[model samples]
Target: MGDVVRAPWDAYFATGFDTCSEVLRGRNWLAPDFAWQERQADTERWEAVATQEMTKTLSRLNAPEHTCQRRSLGNLFDRSTVQRLTPQVEEHVTRLLDELADKLRWGEADFVSTVSEQLPISTIGSWLGIPPEDYPHILEITHNQVHAQELLPTKEQLAVSAEATVQLRAYFTEMVRRRRERPGNDVLTGWIHTWDAREPDRERADEILYRLTMFVTIASLETTATLLSAMVELLLREPGQWKWLAEHPGHIDSAVDEVLRYDPPIHINTRIAAEDTVLAGVPIAKDSMVHVLYGAANHDPRRNENPDTFDIRRTGTHLTFGGGVHYCLGAALARMEARTLLTQLLKRFPTLRTVSPAVYAPRLVFRRVTSLGVAV
Candidate 1:
């Protein structure tokens, strides 16, 4: 396929590194926010509760709103914060590895369920002061919630996503209320105070805090789990790289970046043209939607040498966390989690091996690996 092509469904697909990067970083491109959704012909699709809830998130907002909200929470994932959280990440990794060791003694253990899924929820939940008892429910709802984010969700999937969105809202609303009743020195409580102080309207503050809590939980869970599992799976698949990493533990950072570039958790991102634009000599009209394929672009030979090869030594850049104003706020935290997990995991189980190939769910935009069995 050419770098830019029109899909049969009328959306433009930007698959090359240059084209995708331009669309992502260009000022003329915008996320499909609420206003854009309202302008679409499919009223019923845009009217779904899940769709509406998603458009309100930090990722979907444009310009001034996005700028303001992002600035408010900017320090949450800064280098110092992530560095301060490293010890806690190490503690969680150690605990999870100990549990995995017990399971390995019996037979092959599912790394996905036992370690990958647990670490992220444990870390973020503790940070947000959420009780450990609630993680299982959060994980379930988060998984169901992403169906609506799929490239082409079915009617049934949309309904499931809508229901999940409702459950999440109710859960976070209660959590925010409890935090107000019994304040703690946690991220959620801090946000509550910040929002309340800035906005005199109590109801509006609560609403913003509720959405922030829900978004942080949903954003951190599945995607980080996928990253953790993918790192382990890829390393084990290439025994030499696995052994090399075990010895040269200092290269963990590079290894993490390589894994992100080779197999990102999110493959596609959608953006709309704010005005008439020409991409690679092709004219795109205003309000046209373009699906930027990060996965395809990451493998573009023009951007990196031996693009298909997973070489941790190569210093390569990727669109995994996106670009421009909508760059991922949790990038630093996610990197810290992966690095800590990999370092501790290798130190504990250098002989770890994948007993079976990863089994992924039927997803296009988000890569969801349902199972990855491993033996130590």
Candidate 2:
């Protein structure tokens, strides 16, 4: 079969590395923005508050709107910001690892719960000035809300996502209101001030700020958690690699990149054809939807020498964080979190081993590992 093939569901699946790269980097390929949503025949699905809100997010918008919204938080995960935030990430990783060690002393510990899940939210929550008490609720709602973003969400999943979206909207709305009333030296408060200065209408400005805050917070949680967990899982599954990485801590960055290529947090990204186009000899009509399978592309033999093998020192690129315009804004932060956690984790527990095979949630787009039992 060729690189681009039509799936049973009617959408095209770009499986080859080159095909996926072309789709992502091409100017004609667009995110499923509001206009795309409006054009869809399934009016009811598009009308849901969750779907509507998702389309408005920076991830879903296109062209001028996406450019404008992204520009607002452009430098958020830049080199300087990540460098400034590294020490904090390290601090959290150290504390979480200590807690994990305590749990391991008693018995096998769930690394997903103790470390992977905690570090991302803790780092982002502190940065956004959200109270630590609220992290659990935010995590719960974010988990539910992400179901709506799946490649083929069922009725049940959409309902759950809608409910979660409502809760999230209310939660962020109130949080923005409070921050506006009592300005804090936090990222959210700073955004509120910036939007207030830009937009004349207070209500509109608040809405923009709330959406931005909700997206920023939600975007960082589950994906980064999955990255951290998968990184540990991959390393532990290979004892020699783990030992080598522990001995040579400088390879942690490459190790993290290898894990991302081997098992990315998100496997599929949907893009619509802006105009008539042909990919890998397959003619695609205007407005056609293409599902870029990142996992498949990453493992394509044409892309990597031995795609099945997890080699940390391999020098190649993966579309894990996507490519071009809609590439993940939190990529740098996520990498930093993974690198920091792995660096500290290897240093702390060189003999760490997996208690059993990892358990994963039933998700297509987002690869969520539900549990990873480990012992030191």
Model 1 stretches astray by more than 4 angstroms: none
Against the true structure, whose lDDT is highest?
1
CA lDDT of each candidate? 0.90, 0.89
Model 2 RMSD vs true structure? 1.1
lDDT of 1 by residue, 222-331 (tens): 89999999999988887688889889988999999999999999999999999988987789999999999999999999998899998988798899998888878788
For model 2, what is the alpha-carbon lDDT of residue 14? 97
Model 1: what TM-score? 0.98
Clashes of each: 0, 0
Alpha carbon lDDT at 115, candidate 1: 96
